[model samples]
Target: MFDTLIDQFWSLTLSGIALGFIYVLVSLGYTMVYGVLRMINFANSEIFMFGTFATIIISRDFLGNVDGSKTLPLPKLLLTISLCLIGSMIVSGLVAVFVELVAYRRLRARGTNKLATLISAIGISIVLSEFMRMITHSRPTLNPRILEKKSLFEIAGANFRIDTVLTIVFAAVLFFVLDRFVKFSRLGRAIRAVSMNEDASKLMGIDLNRVISATFLIGGMMSGAAAFFYTLTYENTKFNVGFTLGLAAFTAAVIGGIGNIRGAFFGGLSLGLVEVYASAVLGTQWKSVTVFVILVLVLVVKPSGIFGEAVQQTRA
Candidate 1:
């Protein structure tokens, strides 16, 4: 058992990091919305689900049909993947924006109670999930197995795949770019100003609605990328797929410091590592339990999050 554990170490580590990147991507949506609007967009998970479907639909169009036994030409494979990614991002982003405009905007305009907004979000979440279920008949959509799992390299007797490397590198690059944009871009400054003080930001001539919508769009885009990677890695998705994933991502956001992008990054990585190791030590069934246990511990010790700061205002 000890020898087996030692042999599996590097493989588990790589798997954890790849999975952690997906959590980071999804968690960004939760954290960004919370930072700006101080409201959890429960429906964001549906956006992710949509992205998965979008990728499947678009990739099928490009690749004709999924032939797992046949290998796609390198160029054709890359092109198909690219198209699927773009389609997923656009579809997810638009859905997120639509949700904001249709559901949350009116509530915000009316100065509705936070409870009302929360209830509205929950309703929207259910509606979206059920809608997808109706469309797909609750079937898990599969992706074309274009990139077979071939060993890219070996480290400490563990083999790493090209897919894992691509997932981590691609996600890391996007995260870095987004962090830079938020930290230095003009729109990012506007977003920060609005998050810090909505009334003051409005007084300063910042378009509050635009900033909020942009926040949702950006978050959705991240979730879309996550959706693509997830389908590519796991090869299937169901209408309710986002429920567990969204909860895990949300927990990751809280663990990292909910409202902080950097915190989400760290928190996701930590949670992924914990889940993988816990599952190995205990059982596959205990994986989710480990995540909640960490959540409880984090809440008890630092409710503000490891990287989160307390906000005086809860509503934007």
Candidate 2:
């Protein structure tokens, strides 16, 4: 195991970074919602699950690439991917907003117990997952090969695939844009304000509903993007796929600091690196166990995570 890991260290590192970015994207949704509402949106995983289906639907139905047997010209391929991205993002965003309205809004307005809200979110997650399970007949759905995945480059005996490189770069760009938006835009300010103090923001005439809705929307879109990359990397998805990935993303958010955006980003990459290395060195079956162990250690040592503060207390 040590020899194998040493031989594949660079390759594993690159793979881990790519996977980490996906976690980062998904964790952003959780962190953002927590930032504002101080509640974990368990249903956000279902939001991601929906985005995967949307990507499959667009690829299999609209693009007419069912089994990925057909190869497209570069232009058409780009168009197809763009359409899939847009469709996934839009559908996920809508589902997120709907979840907020149906599962959270009324309960929040009524000033119900936080446990009730969390339970409602979990119920929504179950419903959405089961609904998709029935639709897909509880089978794994394969994603069409939108891009011809080939090795683009190599460094230190490690070859990088085009899809992996693109996924990492694209996710990085999205993160940068999101960071800037959260820091500078008007709506971003509203979100930060609400996260800091919902009552105070409301008193200052900020539309809490609108800001909250937008926060969910943005987070959903990020998850959707992550979903697209996930399918792109893994080439398939299952109805319950969100369960594992969501757990990982939530762990990432917690490790980074639940309510901090930058913390989520760093936490995700850190977890990703740890998981891949552990998988290579220990075994594939030990991956989940290793992640949880790290989680427990982190909590025991520093419950506030790497950021040491929530989003409200930090600029993130």
Candidate 3:
């Protein structure tokens, strides 16, 4: 049994790492938005769901299909995916904006208590999830009939799927872009300032509303991209896809240290690996239960999370 496990390590580990990339990218949005706003974006999963649906609608329904099989050309397919990526981000961002504007932002404008904010977030999350179910109830739509899963090359007798490679690359690029934006961009500086001290930021002539809105937008965009990547890889989707995926990604965020961007990234990767290995050792049915147990243990030992800031020094 031990030797059997070791033999499967190379393949399973690599696959776990690749899959972890998805969680990492999506978790970033959770971390970033929470980091700045001190408010949990409960509807983030909807952002991802909408992103996948957005891409599906664009490629298959919005633009209609191509020739006999009702698909787009390679160039067009690429374009569709690209557009889906951007469109999903945009739409998700808008959805977040609306959530903020209608729910949290208004309450915030009224200076509501933290508990009230949480209640509102939960309410909105339920509404969004149910709304999605109502719209796409029980439909398992296929992804755009694009690339076949194939190997660019093999390493050490391990084969990598095209989707795996693309997911990793996309997540890396997103991390890089986000790192650059936060470190060097002016908007990023404002965000940091706002996160550090909203009152002071406001006193210093920064538009707090605008900055917070921007934070939601960024987070929404990340979730959107995650949604698109998810559907593209899996080749199918349903209205309820957001629930489990959201929970897992949210767990990753908390495990890494909620509000710490880098922590979220690693947390996501670690969670994915742990879950995959747990399934290997236990079984698929036990994967989630094992993951939750690990999360509980980690929280008991370290409430702040692996990489999260102990104090969580935020404006809140």
Candidate 4:
């Protein structure tokens, strides 16, 4: 096991980082919603699921890449990629807002218990997943290979693929932009104000509902972006694809501190690296096991996560 890990260290590391970026993107949604509403948006996974399909739809139906055989010209490929990203983000963001309205707003207005809201979220998740399963007839679907995977260079024995590099760079830039948005923007200030003290924010004339909805929108967009990246790397998706990845992202959020953005990033990267290394050493079968073990340990030994504290108590 050790020998296997040692021999493929750089390869495993690069792969881990790329995969970890996906987790980071998805986990941001969880953390942001938790920061504002103090509720777990279980349906968020489905938001990501929707984004994946949106990518497929935009690429195949609209962009005329119905089959994977088309080799796009450089300019056309760039346009298609941009449009796909935009479509996925818009669709996922809207879907997220719709979920908030259908599953959460009424309950929140009525001041329902947290458990009820949680149950509602889970129900919505199931409904969305089943809806997609029906739409796809429970079959796996493929995304058009718009961007071919080619190794750009090698570091040590590891080859750097285009998709992998793009994923890392894009994730990093998006995270930085989001972090800045949350810390500095007016809407961001409103979000932070509400998270820290809802009553106080309301007194300050901050529209709680708008801020909450905006939070969902931003998170959903991030997940949508993650979906784009996922399809780019894997070139395939399924109705149930989000289930496992969602759980992993949720775990990442928890490990990094549930409401902390930076924490989510750190937790995701760490989990990805650990999972890859563990898989190489112990075998692929142990990947999920390794992740869960880390999750359990984190819960038991440091429930507040590596960063500690919720968004209400921490810096935005």
Q: RMSDs, each prediction?
A: 2.6, 1.4, 2.6, 1.5
lDDT digits (tens) for residues 148-225 of candidate 3: 676887776567778778888897799778867876788888888887777898999998888888888888888888
How does model 3 fare in lDDT? 0.77
lDDT of 4 at 141: 94
Q: How does candidate 4 score on lDDT?
A: 0.90
Select the stronger candidate by lDDT from 1 and 2.
2
Clashes of 2: 0
- How high is the lDDT of residue 316 in model 3? 17
How well is each residue in 237-296 modelled by candidate 4, as lDDT tens digits?
A: 999999888988988998999888899999899888888888888899777778788889
Cα deviation in Å at residue 39, candidate 1?
A: 1.2
**Model 2 C-alpha lDDT per residue in residues 52-103, reported as the tens digit of each score:** 9899889889888775766778888898788888889899999999999999
**Clashing residue pairs, candidate 1?**
none
TM-scores for all candidates: the values are: 0.95, 0.97, 0.91, 0.97
Off by over 4 Å in 1: 1-6, 309-316
Please identify model 4 stretches exceeding 4 Å from their true place.
309-316
Model 3 lowest lDDT segment of ten: 64-73
Estimate the TM-score for candidate 2.
0.97
Collision pairs in model 2: none
| Residues 276-298 of candidate 1: C-alpha lDDT, one tens digit per residue | 77777787887777788888889
